[model samples]
Target: MNKEGLYRDLSTVKQQIGLAKQFLESLNSVKFDRKNVLSWFKKLCGYLTDIILTILEIRSILENHVLNKKTMLLYLYQINTTLSLYINTFVAECEIGEALNEVRIFTTKKLSSCLDGIEDVLIKGISTYPENVGNFILWMDTALEKMSEIDHLKEKEKCLKAFSDAKILFEEVLSHAMSIAQVSMSEDYKIIRGSSQSVLEGLESLSNEISKENPNSAMVKLFAETCSNKLCALERKVNVAVLKICLSTFAKYTDDLENIHKFCFNTENKSKPRDLDNLVMEFDLHVDRIMQIGLFAISCSTNMATCIKIRSCLASLEALESELVPAFNAVLLDYCKQNCNLASILKNHWLNEAVLLKRLICEIIDPLAFCQIVHEENKYLVHTLSLDVKANKSKIDRSVTEQVIRNSIVLDDFLKLITYEEDNIIHIKENISFLQKIIREVKAASDVFLPQEQPELNFKVYKRCKILLNGIYSLCKNFLVENSENSFSKEESLGNEQPVVTGNGFLDHIINRGKQILQDRSILYRSNKIEAFDLRSTTLSKMNALKEKNKSIPLSKLVHLRKISFVQSPTRNQISCELQITDIVNELRNMSLTFEKC
Candidate 1:
């Protein structure tokens, strides 16, 4: 028979066997016939064997070009063997139910094996020829539908597991193919256009499959959507790659301009106007390329993704132009200005302009402009600088104020010990020594403020130093006064306690007047009250008063006080007094003399 006639006769017999099996299953036990059932089963097995033999003949005639011919032959052979086994066992034992059960189990196992075979073929086919993924995916759908017709749950589950594995394999193969296409397109678009077109065709086929109402409809739709999204992303990457090419070309032009900048400033050229003009003209030659790249980028900015890339490229261009043009112009202008200055410096050495210009460009303008550009790049720098400066200033102010206050307290303690009582005298000497040490420390701390270059800070430190010095002078003056007064009081008390040489009234009266004069001196010293004085307030008042009196004393002069001296000598009576009183008067007289010398 011809191929078409044989195929039609085989299909008719297979359909008749399926109808007979269904009719047998619909029968009750009361109506069952072992002879009729066995006849139908034999006929079904014979039809399957004929179909397999016919397919093998067609394979030989057609050179095995049909899809899965070997797998179809293997499944048909196994099913036919199971049917023949059931018929042999039934004829020998006359057990219809047992024979039918054995055949059913065998058939289910063969169907499951068939499903595995189809999955294996799909995996191998798609991987070996990814370009034909469309055909393998269709085969998988048909195989799964056929497996679902089995009555056994275990067999059906096995078929479904194989299908799921096949689906994963297909997705992996398609993704790999897409990656290869993407890479090929990046290298040469024209060469890969055919491959990309084939991928598009495959996707179209998958889309058509998704539109159908089938068992795996959701899975197909999910895969199609994933591929579509990937394609869209790949298209964006293409646009970005084009924009990058334009950016690279524009960068080349900027680099050329930078090179020209270097050539013009090369020291061997001697800053000649002719050489600089030639270099600048060469730099201008790239202007056409820059404009072309800019135009291309602008033209490509039609879509949102490409527009973003184009905007980024444009920003880079703007930065380059802004930086390069200004730098070029500034260098030229500064060279001209400095060259004129160099001419005035050495009228005969015009060639030295090259060295001077190079120094100006390298050492001064370039570094300064770079710093300014960096500072302006981020607006946060100015705000952060202001905050840092304010914080540092406040911290320094607090430290300085606290130091001044501590020094003032020390000076106050030193001044309070001016009274020459024995305890006060000892403390007075210790405080003087302590004050000297503190003055050295304060001076060292104030030296830090001097280098600050702030006039207000220097003046503040100066005022604090002046206050400390005046306190020292005031303490010395009060100590001297109190010493002199104590001396005079001791002399008077000694005179009063002397024996009354009552024979001469005038001598007695003179002694009494002398005592009165000493008392008045003590009263005058007490009224001065310099020990309890506020030296800073006193000095400030004196300054204000001096200003009011039109006598502006210099700080140097104000820090020094006039020393008090005594002209009076101890009389014979004072000398004849107790030795301790005489020694006290003598010490005071020496101290006063020392002050006079100073």
Candidate 2:
């Protein structure tokens, strides 16, 4: 098969695996009888078998394309992580965690072994040993069989699996992950970075020369055209997915620079400084947008050197823009048009402002911290909600539902307020208190139906709520302590008490299962010989250690309003391309289905 065909097969396998996960997740919604349990197992097995077949077919072709093979291996690692998580979720929902303890261990070991092969391929540019793949497939098939037996045993005991039906989510994680590899491989950023640095330096030189009482017209024109050419070069290299998002902006930036040069030297009259200021600001906005896109692209990337270079280039561009603003204004203004002294004063002001701007950029969330903290928190919230719904069979009354919905809107509003009005200490504190109150009310209402006697926090909804509220309180206090004049006591400053990770049969089972998988994965990645023998104590200790560590280090970074707000809406061509790709994958999957029937 060609690359396109291979990609289609991979896409189909991804879809099949997703469907299998969905089927497992729906165990709670559907009556978990023997038939239902057996159906889920069969469906999962079929998906796995199909995926294995596809892998075997692609193995030969994958070997031919070294770079693609690396991407595929990483993709496979992601799939392993996804499968591990889903398997743990299945164990939790089925309340057969004990039965899957050995399964978890063995499966994790096999997957980690597969990871070692993948890493070898990545580091050494060697294909994985065939036995590594064979061994993983063999063990995974056996693991499925073992899980099936456990499911059947649980069904025999009349225990219901607690998984609920969820919307079929498109796993676009691969595309995001691939962007890093693709961008690095393309090295488009190198050209853009180089060009941008040249533009910035050229602009600074132009500004310095223009600041002279007898500015050299030839030199000014030379610097201006050089900047424009560099921008044009940057624009030409915008074919990569990440850079494509900034194409229009980059083009406009080039156009604006050219226009500024034309007005300054080509035209009979120079525009007013205010007019030039507006033009410069418009140009600055485009630069800002480009920087924003670059920040977004690198925020979740693993390539540290690339990120550092890209960011450094952006920062220089920004500082140059700051310097250019005043210089451009001084150069344009008739009163100070030839006043070198006035230009000197403006330059000093610009220097001070540029220093402040860079400092402000630092206050913006560290990109790595943003990914680790914000993304993980979001993922945890999603898992918590899913687990809560699965565990709670009791239906909420319409009144309660309406109330909760309203409270959610209020919470959203308050969160938005906190985000926007970050400087408003009083406003943030008030909203936080309201947020805590609303959460308590919601928990109280939820507890009316969900079993409360299980002190183990078996009702995950309550635990989620507690965590949510505590997180808000902590966030508010952190904001306050950072911005406030008055000092707070240690207890008050820490905000609400953190929810203790207590020992409970259900909770322990879930944590231990997931923990073991993570521990195994960590052992492979990290040099530390960490183990999670006692679930409760280990979990609590780790939580405390993280909390303490985070006290000195920021857990969350403040993201700019503009950064989050910028959405790359797909163009018609992009939409059409996506549809065509989808059609191709569907056709491929249909062919596979026909083959399966035969």
| Candidate 2 accuracy as lDDT | 0.38
What TM-score do all the candidates reach, one by one? 0.16, 0.20
RMSD of 1: 56.1
Worst lDDT run of 10 residues, candidate 2, spans 162-171
Which runs of model 1 end up more than 4 angstroms from their true locations? 1-40, 49-62, 84-598
After aligning candidate 1 to the native by TM-score, how far in Å is the CA of 22 from where it should be?
4.5
Top lDDT prediction, candidate number: 2
lDDT by residue (1-598, candidate 1, tens digit) is 5978756655554454455444344322311245654455545444444433434333333223223432332233333333433334334324323233322343334333433333333223211111121121222222233222221222434435433433333333233223222222233232223333433444445545544444354444454444444333333332322222322332242455556556534545545657666765655444333322332222222222222222223322322332344444444556553333222222111112212222221211111112121112112222342343444443333344344434344334323322244744664566466556655655664667656746556555545554444434434433443433322111121101111122334333323432332222111002212322242233234334434766422211110111121012223112111232233334334433332232
TM-score of candidate 1 on Cα atoms, chains taken together: 0.16
Each prediction's whole-model lDDT (CA): 0.34, 0.38
Cα displacement (angstroms), candidate 2, residue 473, comes to 53
